[model samples]
Target: MQNDIPVAVIISDNAEKEEDDKLPEHKKIVADWLTEEKRRYGSSLEKREREIIREFKEDPSGVRILIVVDKLLTGFDAPRNTFLYLAKQLRDHNLLQAIARVNRLFDGDEQHEAKVNGFIIDYSKNAKNLRDAMALFSNYDPEDIDRALLNTGEKIAELERIYQQLHGIFNTVRNRKDNEEYIRLLEEDVVKREIFYELVNKFIRQFSACGMIHDFARKFGEKKLARYQRELKKFVELKKIQKIKNAEEVDFSKYKDQIRRILDKYVSSEYVIELSEPLCLSETEAFNEFIEKAENGLSIKSKAEAIAAQTRRTISEQYHKDPEFYGKFSKKIEDLITQLKAARQEDLKALLDTAHDFQTQVQNYEDSDIPGELKGRKVYHPFYRSIVSIFSHYSVTSENICLVVTSLYDIIEKNKIVDWAGNIEVQRKVNLEMEDYLFDVVKEQKSIPLTIEEIESIMSSFWNLAVRNR
Candidate 1:
């Protein structure tokens, strides 16, 4: 009760035969627990059952233990239930159902390690009963059941193999203690980093399994187990840094917190890297602030990679915002990374400078590209660009293009009713107005050689762009 860990003693103590103090110590303890349970819910059987079950099912921290005789045996389903303490004897389907209580698959988010397997701690001497039931349950495949029910030794052996393979990733780093060298090796080879992620995940799963399988973990010995904890910690941190160094999405394992707890329990937490969500590079100030913070903690090379990853993602997402501008800087980032990887540009400062330059260009791109006449004209800007692009071969002045933007915008703005974009009649009116402006004003007077096909193409594109911008 003091621990604030809710325990549900789901037994009907409606009318006990003996007094609470007179009962045996264990039973008295249970009686005292039952008394609290009754107190909490106040003699309301329906409320008690519902509240207890609700807490146990929904709240991960609530109802850590449920002293159920058999109420939950059949219909109750809790995916988080990973352990079953057997104290009573049963046979066949009843035994199978009881064991199945813990057999439900469990998955965890970033706060918990996934429960890879269920555990049955038998105090009822039910091993023979379990095997007998499984064997005789003719509905189940004997071979399948045998494969699913792993004994302790098998789990330990599997853990050993996986742990060895996990450490094998960094075997090339001559100084096993040097984290930088390990990171450097991963930095050079992306494939090795991928392999490390997969193997480390398996190792965590296998290690988690061996650690939970009763007393069998003792066979790993104190020194060997300590070594495992240390190496696992090192690998987990390495995996974390590499993910950042490469600018991978923040898909850190749901099991990280649970694994961290396990490691912190056994080892020191000295070399841990904190994870922050990947920021949007389009949010220039936010991106700048985030990078400023990274500058304090991240290495020059890592900071560069982080910047590049973020910039590329933003360019992809905001490409529609300004494809011509975004694509230009996107190419610049690609070239810098290629040169760095090819050993042509080893200076990390150059990468930083390029990124800084890109930031300036993107922020000022609107000011420089949008003429003073069309300044603050958001819809007219793209329209003007489309005119400039479509009539690039002709000698059209910025003033003339601005006039075209005004004319086309007025036509679209006037006809844009509730569903004007989809309404073909509204579209035809817009296209005809645009065609008249493009031909009589631009082609006839300005002599830009704008043809029928070009006018139609411009109308379709400008209509779509207007639909989006407006």
Candidate 2:
């Protein structure tokens, strides 16, 4: 309900009939509403209640909040429940049972929503009720009871502790202003990188949560708060740098809204993070400029790492555009990396040499190793590569390979039509043409010994690549 998400409210159909009470129709109305999703369901209300509860327990997007006057306050158990908003007054065992709803631990899910602790917002001024309930219903000491609940001031203290820990990692650098040094240290090892990511992400979440409190802003003051805002920006840029240098898929989905809140609250719009994406290989000047602008103290290995990461990223993203063509170069670069990693000697210079070659190759992919006849025919290159890949294991000579590729290209060019990739009719026609040519021309006329199964496999790859190319 906080961000336009739907909240679920469950009313017990099991409530005792109150003939003497006002609003006698309330229970039935609520029961009908519970099952009234989409339309009024014909199923039993209790079954529908269990279904919603199950959804809330398992799905991150399901049932953000629960409003219940009774029933569920007792037997309902969901470890994923992280927050409880109490409005009705209850004491002793009932209050204790309600408080226990959110006390369980959950070690994150696939959506990355982790629950280390629970929160309770007492709207009914339940301070006295909580203390009284503990004193009357529990067998615990006074100070022990006090430890169970904390004041809002503790949130500020926790935020400060996380901030200090996050900055403590960078204290080794004499020049704190040198962002490259901090990023390089993060890239030094995977553990440090993970710790940095965890701490900074926690800091941002804490800051976002506490910023809503008026006292938090007043306590930190304007200047100190501005400094923290800048720190958020710094963390964002460092994340971007690490992602590109490591070629990791960092999930920023969790912080999308929180980051927008932090930036929009500031006076200047200059604090915005506006970079398009990871540098694309096709854009030479921009990509080179990004690589050249690495941190000041980074070694030659770091530059090469950036190039390799970007090259891999480019191949992965653009592979679909021309899989047969990109597939060839992708294999070459990965083989080079595997070879470098497996080498007995640490020949980083050689690694750097290979990485630079891959970078240039990505930018000039169409210019190298193309068949003589397919040299100016860039549109036919991917198909030609597909043909080459299919016949690569055979003893077919280079001239014979070119001859097979151009013949298939002519067959495809003549049969292909508008939107040929999606049109089943066009694909069927192309497949027939390819199969006939492979059997009639490639098998009989050229004396190639390819099997029917091999011909089908090649045609399958071609059509798949054709769909992607489209």
Candidate 3:
């Protein structure tokens, strides 16, 4: 325990005498260390020992490190503490209490600023013991454990499917002469050959046990396994060929490079395109904005709620104008219904055509007043396309958008009228329903498990930095 890491042993003063005492050895070890320190320092030990221990117990600034063996874990509160290296085995309430010592809030800290890192040195073989230890302090719930296993299984299943597809493509390509020529060119290019090898090797290693590609060969069928090995060997041979110049050195190097290059080009254009895009700057900006609003104690959820209310108000106003304004709105509604019916059986492309026809009809109407100013705005075409595409292709319900938009349109119409005739009671009900639906969606998307205090601290820090430029 004391080879390189600094050591401290804290134990209950009355560990041997206490009625509930069960850890006598723990007390003895700590007591022995303290006595030795006392002897080494002589009479001077009396002055310094109590003060040093008390200050450590206090754990103020400049306490760079601490390595504990049982003692100070129980009722300790050290805000500056960062790491919790668990050398001793622990579980249940005792383990919970020990880890909690490092989780205390410190000054100028944004909630979880203290990094409670753990290093397990003893229970290396017992994975269950390590998991049980984690359950003491973290949210390692049973359901979470099941979900993690399910995700792992799904990943393995997906990888198995991809391997099968790749093998099918490889078999087809291997029979073709032109594909063989392509492989030759890839072999000639060192960079291209390396890329292809890495692509195969990464997937191979991901499924590999103990970092061995041989594990993949043993698990999958021999035919596909042989192909991977064959291709991989070709790649390595090409790498060697590129460096060789003389007749003896040239040997099989040129042949290997030529074969590998052909295979590399095929894999890239066919297989790699299907993978999901990595996070980009636009996504980062969206996330940063969200975090900023959270830190400022501002709620996008609440703003959306207010928008729902405004939408409802506009709908109420629009519904009040007699058969003149009302008639015009009803026409748009009829057109929407007609297009929706067309979209029901149509695919995305056909649905877009139907939406375009309806929009074109609206444009042709001599009575229309949708404003030329709104035409060709970047969002207008996209918004219309999204509406049509989602209605025709995706699973998201279009009723939510219609209910909110229609309600808002009605409210705007009502406000324009000198004398309103639409039923106020009906508008109120629609408004309430819209609010309920919008709030439910917001809650489903944004709800988190942190305490209110914790959330506020995180949001504040996030916004201060994120909104600084905005």
Candidate 4:
């Protein structure tokens, strides 16, 4: 019956090359349905984007279609974009952002309408298994939500019972526990704790998205667990209101806000701290040394120290000019630049100036800093080339761009030593890694919230395999 509904399928990628395409034809078909009515919308983007955006602009009854393989997943908007057919596996903030595509309001649509209207008709077999994953954080009630989930109703009901049992155990503990209630409490604690942990593991199995999991985990598992009680109570209250059919314009704002607060708290406390601390420490140490040396009243290091520093700088410059080196780092830089250009609201001149600065630095390094060992024989500069490439990819806030370029320069100065024979290879390798470091900083500044793991797997992988080769 669901498939029997009149649906317009949109095909963005060539259906024949299903494996080669990022999204399969089946999934792309759903994406295409959402954007089928192109001209009805204000302006036309790529035929691909139009296909995705059109569904929102014009309402064609019974037109329940699917789209396959498209790039309009981000930076596009449509109020009628109520249904998001997610065939893709997403993680971190990306998962949230993608689903958010359908969360915007329509004319009479209020909070719950906006929230629940964002449906995902998932045909992707893998995606079906992961349906309950996001619901844990999105405050989605398994029963209230439609056949949105792919598994058996009984399986989902069982999972709910387990959660309910855990809640009951928690309630039992709350009811008693005098000074002498040690043994029973401890025994129950172990059982309850196991259930709690198992719930977390099961949640993870359903939702690969950490932003969703970490957000819900803290609410249900960590600090102020009373909030979870409150939320669950609210869920019960909402079900009653819906059942009465007398609830006019349900206020999901309070509930949505509570969940959002939990998410923010989890992100700030759990995810960001553990993931970023180590990298931040390393970057700070390297930057601190550079700042201190640059700031010293005057400069006349001991001969030994000067020799060591100069040799290191020389080796770094030599490695920068290596052909293999350029082969590796150039395209990542360009991709970074392109993303900046696309995302940011900056003046053209300012962007060009930043690009010029990167270019000048690269040229200067090539001509003056590259070691004589690799001179006259056509050496490449992957680090500098990468800088240029990344600059091209993104259009960033001027201040952010300034910070990024300065950071890139600092990384080169601190890590790369062109003259040192002993450290040339090491410096070169570090520069290669710096691409990853610089890319993350730029992405964050652009307000693109990605997990370090996602950054490494998606953006970094894209950089290394596609950008570098191109």
TM-score of each: 0.75, 0.60, 0.23, 0.21
* Top candidate when judged by TM-score against the true structure: 1
Off by over 4 Å in 3: 1-7, 11-32, 36-62, 102-127, 130-140, 143-470
lDDT string, candidate 3, 1-470, tens digits: 35553444443344335433454776666556666665876734445535545555454331235555446655566554545556556766666566566555332232212221222233323335536766765776766544422243444465566455434434534433343343444434666555544444434333331112224334556675456545544433332222211001112221222223323443453222211112122232332243234322322222222222222233334333222333454455455444543443334344444433433333332233322433433222222222223223334344443432344333334443332335465445544543443344322443322344433332232222222211
Model 3 residue 437 distance off true place after TM-score fit, in angstroms: 74
Residue 32 local lDDT, model 4:
59
Tens-digit per-residue lDDT, 1-470, candidate 2: 76888587676554335432543576556644554642554555666678778878877667767777677877789886877888777787888898899998765543434455677777787767878888887676788656666545777788889888878888887888776678777876688789888887787677766665546777777887788887887776687667666666555544554566665666343333343133444565565575567443345566667777778887988887677667777888787667655554467778888888888877666647776766887666777677675677677876787777677666666777777767888888888998998999888987888987889987887777667765
Decide which is better by lDDT, 1 or 3. Answer: 1
Against the unseen true structure, what C-alpha lDDT does each candidate score? 0.70, 0.71, 0.38, 0.40
lDDT of 4 at 251: 33
Q: Flag clash pairs in model 2.
A: none
RMSD of each: 5.3, 8.2, 22.7, 25.2
lDDT of 4 by residue, 382-416 (tens): 33333333444455443443444445544544653
Q: Indicate the worst ten consecutive residues by lDDT in candidate 4.
A: 240-249
